[model samples]
Target chain A: MEEIKKHVLDCSNLNCPMPIVRIAKTIRTIEVNEQIEVTATDPAFKADVEAWIRKTGHLLISYAEEGRSRIAIIEKTK
Target chain B: MEDQKLKEYIDALVEEKVNEKTLAFQNQLENIQQQLSTVQVRENEKITMLVTSFELDKVIPAFIIANGAASFGMDVTLFFTLWGINALKEKSIYKGKNIKEKMITMMLPSNPKSTTISRLNMMGVGTSMMKMMMKENNIETLPDLIDLSIDMGAKLIACQMTMGMMGITTDEIRKDVDFGGVALYIEEASESNITLTF
Candidate 1:
């Protein structure tokens, strides 16, 4: 069986600097090639998570609005 | 006999000396009075108060000010609201494990949860490490800090709207807190010259 290529992080209950902060912490523990999915409810996370991806050299895979929240997926680039 | 008495009395009379004083004394008195008037009504500047909503990195500066203001004799208030309320929580007394974690949270962009983990991670081995470090460093735990804040008359209030939305009752807040509506905080902010949101 192929290794699990992606992991999902549900950070909907958190506020600003929280979703990205937790994602960053979770990312630090993950394998180099694995990707992480971040689901957040904070309206400010759309801009912040994207900004973090851009600034930290992470791959912005996809971001979509699901129901009342947003799902953002970022792949570790380095 | 009357002529002899008049001569004797006239002989006893003495000449008076002429008094000498300068108009400069009057000028000196006027100058002293003018100087005294200028010295009396001098004013010290009115104090400024700063109110802040706490975040990890966002709140450190404000916390420094809140603690330091008393030292400077300036009035400072930290108004915790929403997620900002976490800073005042009993669980938030943790510092980062390493110097890097400390500097990152204290100086750079960092979150509250990671800060707790990082601080605990650095303490020593496991659960006991934090307690050991607390003892070794002579630092109070989060609960102690909260209690101290209460004893010191630091205003710690829960946001009524946030509590209602989050389904937290007034009892969930620290018993020492003075709870009320947004109007209370607004009244505080309006009274304060400076209001900050984090």
Candidate 2:
């Protein structure tokens, strides 16, 4: 599905937990059902985000890799 | 008439059994909810640190750990005693050109910035090299971590008895620090889930 993104959180050059920390803070302002894209360089970004999404009941629209960077889109479900 | 009494008695008994089963099921659901609530509380657990190491390597790591936990919304408390209080001091009590005090200041790190590693410090050269390495790796410097800890709400506590024993005046240390004693540290640690001594 082609999901239109409104917010982008660029966490490039950030280390583990920083990206996740920023996402936790940023996701609060987002409206439910609207998609947000998180781009990160941390090798553990995929695993961290996936776990957080699962716990928070958010919708993971899709995930893809770009070069050495990891990108994931999530929609706030609650 | 006897048959009617028997039927009524059976109906009453069945109703009581159904009520008891419903109550038991409701209690089970409550217990599951309580278990989930505890998991969420663990994320916001309290962390307490008793930092006594004045060694540059040890002190820097202490700040990093405390601040890192604080970033995740944990309640962090740092109890500074003896040499640990030196990290919180902005200026040494041994200042103003008193020969003996000056010599003591020279012997010690005096402040967080001038701290040297406990081991492998080759006449201060190793410390400078370590700082350079941290920069190259994008790790926050000791001072940066300390500032972040303060800004992000980590409580910094100084031991009152240690200050008196070492002749350190309140004015020498940062004003933001709260003065406490061993008993105070114990009180805070009693309720803390994570207690670390560095």
Q: Which candidate is the best by lDDT?
A: 2
Clashes of each: 5, 0
lDDT of 2 by residue, B1-198 (tens): 999999999999999999999999999999999999988876656889999988878888788678656655578999999788889878776554457546655676667888888887899888888878877766666766677678768899999987776667788888788998988889889878889999
- Residue B65 displacement (Å), model 1: 3.2
What TM-score goes with each of the models?
Answer: 0.35, 0.68
How does candidate 2 fare on TM-score?
0.68
Find the 10 residues in a row with the least total lDDT in model 1 chain B. Answer: B43-52
Least accurate stretch of 10 residues (summed lDDT) in model 2 chain B? B95-104
Quote the positional error of residue A48 for candidate 1 in Å: 36
* Model 2 ranges off by over 4 Å: A1-7, A16-37, A44-64, A72-78, B1-43, B95-103
* lDDT score, candidate 1, position A14: 60
Per-candidate iRMSD: 14.6, 3.6
lDDT per residue for candidate 1 within A10-36, as digits (tens), equals: 987565444665676677778776888
C-alpha lDDT of residue A60 in model 2 = 88
Chain B structural similarity (TM-score) per candidate? 0.44, 0.73
